[model samples]
Target: MTRYHPFLVFLHWLLALMIIGGLIMGGNVLAETPNDDPFKLVALRMHMAMGILILALMVIRLVVRLVTTKPPHADIGNARVNKLGTAAHWLFYVVVIAMCASGLAIANMAGLPAIVFGGSGAPLPSDFSAFPPRMAHGALATVLTLLILGHVGAGLWHQFVTKDGLFGRMWFGKRS
Candidate 1:
């Protein structure tokens, strides 16, 4: 079986790290920082930056995927599994795009607080629920987290239970 291209592998791992980091930062900014905390805006800004980077990288990754030759899917003796894997991959892209869009909408609706960038503080909305984008962003994030867990579990299952060497397809370097 053919292995994934090196650039594709790089993009995969890079985006994975960025996405996970963004998620962690977002959680900290949203849950850990009190609304009254001076640093809350700073955290929000950082998360926003991370989200933008993810969006840019994801766009580039999609373009690369479109132009490059992808390895063939494994014939794991089950057409249903192959279809599920394909659908899951697409789901990841969809969720990421949705998350970024909603996040941007939230920032826009909130007027992109200048305080997030070290400027004088601007008052945030006292009620986040008043912003429809905030609600969508939160809901999408929850779905993304669940999808990530399912993706990881599927990878592990392929690596161990299936033993089809499918995991090696995404690993770095040449297959032995």
Candidate 2:
């Protein structure tokens, strides 16, 4: 039996909070942006920055998971909990990476400068000019919706049915 990687657990929940918050906020920003307003451009640029940060943190998380010895799990925790978790996590990464790429794509379609969260800027790859970022962003958002539903369902299962400690690790930083 392996012990829960406490630090990894912390980063996981923290990133989840940030990603969900950013997504919800970005959606509102996009909806509220006026069709003819220049301010919409600025808001999109900032959304790009937020996407970049999410990408970087996700990469860091992947690296950490690669090097760490993940704790063991008991089968009875939930009937299909492990499978759902694995799928949800990988899909979560896919949607996040796609969101970042799509944000850059949309910016390129407008011929705008790259919005780098870490520094002054980076140029958008010329390939991003092919189409609007909306397609990819929309696809990612759709998947994100499903994943969020799956995640919540799993949590409720743990809370009400299985009565397990799985959710506790991510929610409160340790097993109850």
Top TM-score prediction, candidate number: 1
Q: Give the whole-model CA lDDT for all candidates, comma-separated.
A: 0.80, 0.68
Query: Positional deviation of 173 in candidate 2, in angstroms?
Result: 6.0
lDDT of 1 at 154: 82
TM-score for each model: 0.90, 0.75
- Badly placed stretches (over 4 Å) of model 1 are 118-120
Which pairs clash inside model 2?
A: none
Q: After superposition, how far is residue 36 of candidate 1 from its true place, in Å?
A: 2.3
**lDDT for each residue of candidate 2 in 90-174, tens digit (9 for 90 to 100):** 7877788788788776766655563333334444343332466776776687678778888888778777898866666554343
Off by over 4 Å in 2: 1-3, 73-81, 114-132, 171-176
